[model samples]
Target: MAILMFISRVISLFLMVVLIFYKRKEPALLMAWLLLLVFLPPIGCVMYLLFERTPLPRKAGLFLNDIKDERRGRQASVSLNDKITSLVHFNENYNSSRLYLYQDFMYFADGKSKYQQLFKDIEGAKQSIHLQYFIIREDEVGRQLVQLLTEKAAQGVEVRLIFDSAGCFGTRLKYFASLMEAGGQVYQFHPPTFRLIGLNYNYRNHRKIVVIDGRIGYLGGMNIGNEYMSLDPKFSPWRDAHLRLVGDAVWELQHRFLKDYYMVCDHQEDERYIKDHLNHYFASPLSTTLCPMQIVSDGPDTTTDDIKLTFVKMIQSAVHTIQIQTPYFIPDSLFLETLKIAAYSGVKVEVMIPTIADHHYVYRTTTSFIKELREANIDVYFYKGFLHSKIIIIDEELCTIGSTNIDQRSFKINYEINAFIYDKTLTRQAVHQFQLDLENCLLVDDSYEQNKSAWIRFEEKVYRLVSMLL
Candidate 1:
């Protein structure tokens, strides 16, 4: 028995060494994993296997390989006014995402308005309706969505839905049974089978998108849940932002949905069947409006953090002011330092985060970061209500709104998508909304730190230490 125990210990130590050195993770993340592995060997190994050590889904890998040759020959041309050429070119070169000129834009600052518009669009769908969300609760909102999709499918309009398996864990299969019976296809991204366990829970599909007939697209922070509509008593008056876009930009959104749909449903025998049916969705008629936009996406599948780099570039290009709104504010070192540099360069930096705690660890980490920003003379606002909006406006010339948050999880882990809008008119509207939201926020200054007790400060330090994993 003694010899057997010694052998087990040696094997575990060897595994830990491999994990610590072989994985090319950030220093902070590596240290966090190392601490876990050393202090709690058995539990840490399970945690690492469940969360940190998985690759992209196998079907997604195969799909990417199949498209590699086709994508390599794809053109990088886009029609954009010279005013936004530099920024558009930067994104194009970074991720090969083409800039598209949209005809019209509708901004929804709350879920009620956004859902209303989305339902109307879905009701009017002619050929197809594609919907994807991180969360779809088994609540009234979710039922309504399923019923609508069922009706549309029964009417002979092709409908496809995708939801993150972990996000909708509690939702039973019966909830979507009726929709499937009506010929609507439903896929749960990264569903936990017995063989897979819950290994992919950390790498969620955080994107929220809906494309209708390949002509109208909606993308932003609002998920399909009653809580998002402020119907849940636990989180009433929910704040969020979503956009309804029409024109060539919708083509990009449709393309994204197609790729994700194919990846999720790649096991189907007729792989090219859906592709052929949806080929018409990519056709874009000429549009006259000049609202330039790019849909940027990133995930563990790709090594490059395109959205994070884009955020840094936006901050570096800001000349006068930077305004941001997000539910969470646990920024990584690079993002934090960029904001500090921008603030020190005579640029006004303003950030708004929710005062309420959705996740205790995240809330504590946010407070710590807010204190750091305050010390650097960067303005921080604690919103009175729960602010779930993810928005950023730079110099009233560029704006981004979507599921990506300014945090480590969003920057390096989860799958996220954002709309980079480069139009003065749309940007000014976003700026105006940010200013209005300031009315419900309390500014944090140097004195804010004085109220923290020694115990709370220590707790915050501990939380900040493990925030990268959070």
Candidate 2:
């Protein structure tokens, strides 16, 4: 046993040295890994081996180049406001995302309404339907969606789907057998050769996107599950945010979905065909409304944390107020500092988090940040129910809504997407929804952290030590 302990320490030291050299760019993450190795040598080394290696193809840029067309003309004219010009330029340069002028936008705060419109749109697909999700459970809601896709496929509309293997671990392929038999093409993102065990286990495609007939698109926080519809007693009255969009932005959504599909799908000939006929997958914009937004995406393949930087830019741009809602709040040092700096600069920073936890360790880590935020004069709200909305409204002129959470995993690890809307009308609507949500929350004050139980406080401290992994 002593010899085994010595060998473990030696191995841990070797990994620390290797990680320091390989991960010099990410100092914070490197430090976390090093600390983990020091504290729990054997288990930490195993985790580093399992999770650090990415299974994603390295030629992500080549795949992106295939989908883009410099020869194509812009479908909608866009004029950016001066206030958001820098933000727009940053997303454009970093993410290769163009500002799209969308004509229509609809926000859904519940699953019932979002699914109603989504199902209707799927039912109305004329040419094709592309759907991507992190999770598609083998439940009532999931079957209903599959049934709709199967019916659509049988009717001759092209149906395609890409689901993350890790996210749908328990869901059997037989569940989607009917859809596939009906001519629908389904692909799993980075499926392990053995069930639920692989190097790609840590990296997940957490994006939720649906593009129907290349005209309408749907994206945001809610996944396909009976729990999202509040059928599960554990998380009753689920609150989440989703968007239904029509105009040039839908084309961008289609592009993003196709990019993910290209990575997961093995048919090279089909990819070449899709690349050749891009216009068939992207319908011409008909709306003339002047709503400008950028669809930005980030993941492990990307060098920089584009979405996190985007969030920082949004936070820094705030001159009046910053209101944010997220289910998880384990933000890294930079993000936390930005919020504190914004609050210090006299911006009214308000953050709302759910009271119930879907993951215990993550929930505790989230609570650990409350004292720091409260001490910095930032207002924290404990939402009554499951608040799964990933939204941030700044200065009532700009807002971002999508799958991104204020956590390390969403910022740097998972494949995520968000829409940075630079329109006041929509921002105001989001702000209004946030204000309404405040009604069902308890505003944390000085005494809230002071009143924590010793055990709870200790758990929070311990969990926060490894918050980066969470």
Candidate 3:
């Protein structure tokens, strides 16, 4: 018994040392892991092993290394206006994403319209179609998408898809068998291993991207599910934001898809084959219009949280107004503090979130942050229905639309992509949409804090304690 106790003590000490030395983690996250390790040795060690290990294997970096030099060379030659150039330099320097001038842009404020346009683009695909989504239900909408892709595949179009294993847990493999039979390929991101145990459940592919015919692209928060279409009665009137892109921007989206595809499919093709295929797919004619834009992506694969840093840059750069819409608002301390600073600096900061939540704990935890935000002079508004849009607009000249949420899960855990648009016309359209959404929102006043019960407050504390893991 003494020997066994000594072995356990050694293991505990090892884990404590590992937690303390883990680099790049926030101080609070490090402390939380340390507490878990000290209090619950066995369970915490197992949890750390399964979830907090290396987020992305070192081998994953090789997937995109072949094109890095070529892309950087091309980006260096692109010219931009003064305002757009500054933003581009920031992203290129900090986020490592290059800016491209898109010819056309279309914004969708609802899933129905987004899906309509997506299907139209898919139907017109002549060469290839690439799609990636977090969730793809086996419901009516999913069936229709599968059918369409299968038909396109049958017509000799290259159709490839990727879905998150955790997000599509309820979706059966049989639902996609027909597409596979029709010569299309489907891959699941980070599927369960070890006999159905998901070790990578903490990291998910939450990006929604569709590139059709190597010329048109779509992305945003709307997933391929009935819930996003308001067909799920539980969360009806789903409000989301999506964008359609046509021009050089599609190439970046294509590059992102190829990286993800190579990682999942484990393609062993030679470098020559990869280079040839990339050149062919990215050879689409450039658009005549020059609308400044940048496609930024971030994931657990890298130590730097580029999307979160982009958010901070947006807040810091805003001079007059900052508007945001997200389904979840359980932000990290840095995110909250940045917004507070922006508001205190005389910027009109407006944040809109859903009054009804699909995740109860997430909603409650979001409510817990309201008191602090209001005290900082930030305007907080709750939409009457579920608002699933992830949008941010600053000064009516810059805006971002994508799958990233204002929560720890999106900022630090999941894979995300956003399109930063630097155009007055598009920004004005986004601002108009934000104003329209304000009609459906109720601005929270001082009474919001006074009405919370003791149980709710306790629950908030408990949820906040583990918010990093959530």
Candidate 4:
């Protein structure tokens, strides 16, 4: 046993040296792992082994390359404001997200309205329906969604669904047996290989997207659950944001869904199937409204942090005002610095977060940044109820809404998506809604941190030390 202990110490030291060299660029992440190793060597080594980064399957890359080759020169050029032109160009070059003119943009601040419209669209589906969510509980809402998709599949409409295994941990594959029996396809995103070992557990697919009939698309924060509708007493009055987009933008969403589908779908199936259905999946729609939008996505499969960089660009372009709402606020150093710079430049910067705690360590880590953020002259507001919306509005002319939090997890670990809208009308609508939410918020002034109990402050410090892993 003494020899075994010595060997473990040697291995841990070796791992730490290797990590310091390999992850030198990510200082915060590297520090978090180093702290973990110092305290618990065995557990930290096992975690590092399980969660180490690896590129996406080679077959997935080949599939995306073929699709990219076919999609070249398909995007239409559009005139954009000088301030946002660089931001748009960055997303196009790095994320390969094309711009589209959406005819209709409907924003939902409540889950009831969003799910009602989503179900209606599903009922009206004629050809295909693609739905993806990070969580799908075994509750009334989840069952209803499965039933609806089963009915659509029974009606000869192609129905495809993807859910993250880690997010829906207790959910079994049998939960989707009925949908599969009805001829609908359901795939779990990166399930565990062994009963106790899940290689992709740390990297989750956090995107919530829906595409119906190649014409309508939805993407945002609300997942499929009764809690999202405020039916759960623990998290009553749940607040979130979702977007229902109609027009050519839906084609971009459809393309994104197909890419994820191809990643998990059987590669043994004839590749000709995707080629044959390309036109059907990307049918163009004629619309009059010119609402410029870009559907941007990022994941751990690539090295580029596209969404985080896009957020940085958006904050940098701010001239008059910036408002951000997110449940989690454990941002990286760069993100925190950008917001501080914006405030220093006289941009009215405001951020709203929830007063409640869903995850104890994560919530504590979020509060840990409050003192630093407040010192930078940024106003911080704690919503009276649970605030789950991931939104950022700039100058009442541009806004982003989707399933991305202001944290390292969303920026680097999870598969996330967001819609960057560059329309004055839609952006102002978002700003107006944000103002309404602010009425129920409690501002954190100079004395807010002084009143905190010693225990609470200590918890924050402990959590903040390893926040990057959260």
Candidate 5:
């Protein structure tokens, strides 16, 4: 009995040391794990040991070595700065696609507009329509969208749909089958039947993308649900942006869609996706001078976390004021430092978030970060409405508007896509729109700083402790 007690003491001491020595990045999580181990004894200890150990892929050095070959080399080779000045900096270091094979144009500001446009595109499709989304509900919005997609498939549009297994789990299985039987090729990304897939639940396809006729494309944060359309009435209106590319970027989206399709369907599209000497797909003579843009996607398979790297580089390179509009502000240490540095360097840095959160705990975590940011001279604004837009305008020289958020889920967990535009005209247009939105926005001023309620202030302080994991 004494020996067992001694061994237990040794283990406890070791774990306590670990809790401090190896920073958890998220402090709230560390305390939770500590509590679990203290009360649950051997079982909690084992659980903590199994779960807390950083997964192989997330460990810093191991990840870099794994993708060292696929690093910036593959991406930096394709540069078109001569065609687009905004890409001048990126061009100096990277490469870009040689030529685009397809093009499509689309424009929608909100879910109602987007879905309505999506249905029309699907209905008009003659050859094929590829669709992918992070979430699709059986609610009014999902059912209505699915009904239209089914009819389009039945009409021989060759529709193919892919949904993340975990994301679509909330919807009925029968609904998925109905679409498949109606000629819609439905495949679940990382299906549960495969053990390799079940290994991690966090790596999800959080992208919402649609491609029709291999010509037109749509991609952004808008998922298939009533809440997104403001039709649910339960939540405030969904505010988001989606771009319709009419130039070579459409082919890049097509390539990504096919890549996801093949990744799940397990077949190479060598003949179809080949860089042909003959050039079959017609290029739209529409000069990219219109809105020269390229779609960049980041995922687990990629050589580097390009999306995260892209934002970090862009923020660091900002010459003018940086305006960030993110619904969630749970940034990692690197991003947090960049923002602080930006503010201290005389950049009029401003961030707008939601005053009332759609998600409870997440909002708590957000408040903690907001306080720190407010202290750092980063003007923080809380939209009275649900500000769901993920937008960034830096120096009026660069603007990124797309599905990617500035939270942990977007940066470290889910697959996301963003359109980095090099057009000064578009950046200014977006910046002006953002400023207009800020008019209705209330800044978290010195008033909130001076006398926030005890309960709210206490809650925010507690939330900050755990902001890393949130």
Candidate 6:
């Protein structure tokens, strides 16, 4: 048996190395895999088989994106060169759809108030409505919102909803039965089954978008739960921020919602959802002028990874400063390199991560980055309270705010969306809040190591290795 085990290990190791080279995965990661397979052949083979060569559901998600409308195909075919020429300061392709309707924008500073605004929006919806969330818990907050969605659907508002499968797995399936009964449609994105057993388990739909009457849209990191609203007994006084986007951007979010809707529900649009319901609020040359915002989304299906590319572009083009606040800070090699180079070049980079992480492992990895970043002269701030805001302010002119966090999961795995803003007023508006949050934060520079226990730092090092998967 021992001899046979050795023979099997040799065969698997040979195949794994051959496949890794053939696939052309990152050189460093491939080397790591080679080392892992040499020592732990069976486990490494399983990992590689499940991910790099798992030719089933993954292939399906890759080749089988929903068909875009004929209108969309035509629009997509057009060269955005004209739009690009006007927005020469920033990449024109990153600009938001000029025709997408968004009028006003509101910043929800308090997390709980986001839910309050949601309830009011639901109450006021006249016609069609679409709402999507990553985590739809069965807790107090979830039950209340579910009941409300049912009521709205019953009123013939064309209500539809969706949630992430893994995120809502613990919540009882029966809790949402009312939604179906009221002609409400709810579907889960990338539901985990026996088939999809791999590293991609972390790829979640992190977007929190609520579109009403094709008008008002809300999105950001805040999920639907009492913990987010401080109604959950487990966590208290939830602190987070969500953006209320009105005008042309709302349609883009609505378009995003429908894409997910089609993926999960496979339902066709109402024929005229766009004709009558769409309210394209384009920016004028002055009050609104080509504010050039793009609703960039990233996930497992695409190779480009829009959010990650956007980060790379912004970091590469940054002129003065970059401020980032995220719940989790587990970026891969390229992203980390970007930040290190920006800081090393004196770009006044500041990153605010929670002093105490919601996920303990995430917190550990974040501190490890802090130790390195502080060494490179980047400002690191720790918030005393739980910080759930996910935003980036660059050069006080370009800003990004949305549900996406700066982590591997958000960049390469999760179905996340963000609004990239170029307008100076919006940047200032977000930066003002960032400044206030900075006031509440404790800076860590030249002294973080002296205050920590050696054992704690050791734990952080161990956790940092797993951050790629976390």
Q: Which has the better lDDT: candidate 1, or candidate 4?
A: 4
Q: Write down the lDDT that model 1 would get.
A: 0.80
Q: Between candidates 2 and 6, which one is better according to lDDT?
A: 2
Q: What is every candidate's alpha-carbon RMSD to the true fold?
A: 3.2, 2.4, 2.8, 2.3, 6.2, 4.8
State the lDDT at 10 in candidate 4: 79
Q: lDDT score, residue 210, model 3?
A: 93
lDDT tens readout by residue for model 4, 280-299 = 66666656688888889888
Spell out the clash pairs found in candidate 5: 76-94, 76-95, 77-94, 77-95, 77-96, 78-95, 78-96, 79-96
Q: Which has the greatest lDDT?
A: 2
Model 2 misplaced stretches (Cα beyond 4 Å): 1-7, 25-28, 53-56, 59-67, 71-79, 193-198
The lDDT, on a scale of 0 to 1, for candidate 2 is 0.86
Which ten-residue region of model 4 has the weakest summed lDDT?
53-62
What is the Cα-based lDDT of residue 175 in candidate 5? 83
Model 3: which ten-residue window has the lowest total lDDT?
Answer: 71-80
- Which pairs, if any, clash in model 1? none
TM-score for candidate 2, residues paired by index = 0.94
Model 6 Cα lDDT, one tens digit per residue, 376-427: 7888898767788888888888778888888766776678888877666778
Query: Candidate 2, 173: how far from true, in Å?
Result: 1.3
Higher-TM-score candidate among 3 and 5?
3
Question: Tens digit of lDDT per residue, candidate 2, span 345-390?
Answer: 9999999999988999899999999999998899999999899999
Tens digit per residue, CA lDDT, model 5, 1-470: 77875676577667767777865445656666566556645655555443342332422222222222222111223444442444544533442422332333454557888878777777787767788988898888788878888888888777878888888888766786777888788888766542332234446787878877756777866788887777665467556666666555655666566666656774444333333311222223343334555567766555455676667777777766889888888887788889889888888898988765787777877777876787789999887777777888888766777778887768765667887776676678778767877886898877775686888878877666444432
C-alpha RMSD (angstroms) for model 2: 2.4
TM-score of each: 0.91, 0.94, 0.93, 0.94, 0.78, 0.85
C-alpha lDDT values of all predictions = 0.80, 0.86, 0.83, 0.84, 0.67, 0.70
- Error of model 2, residue 412, in angstroms: 1.4
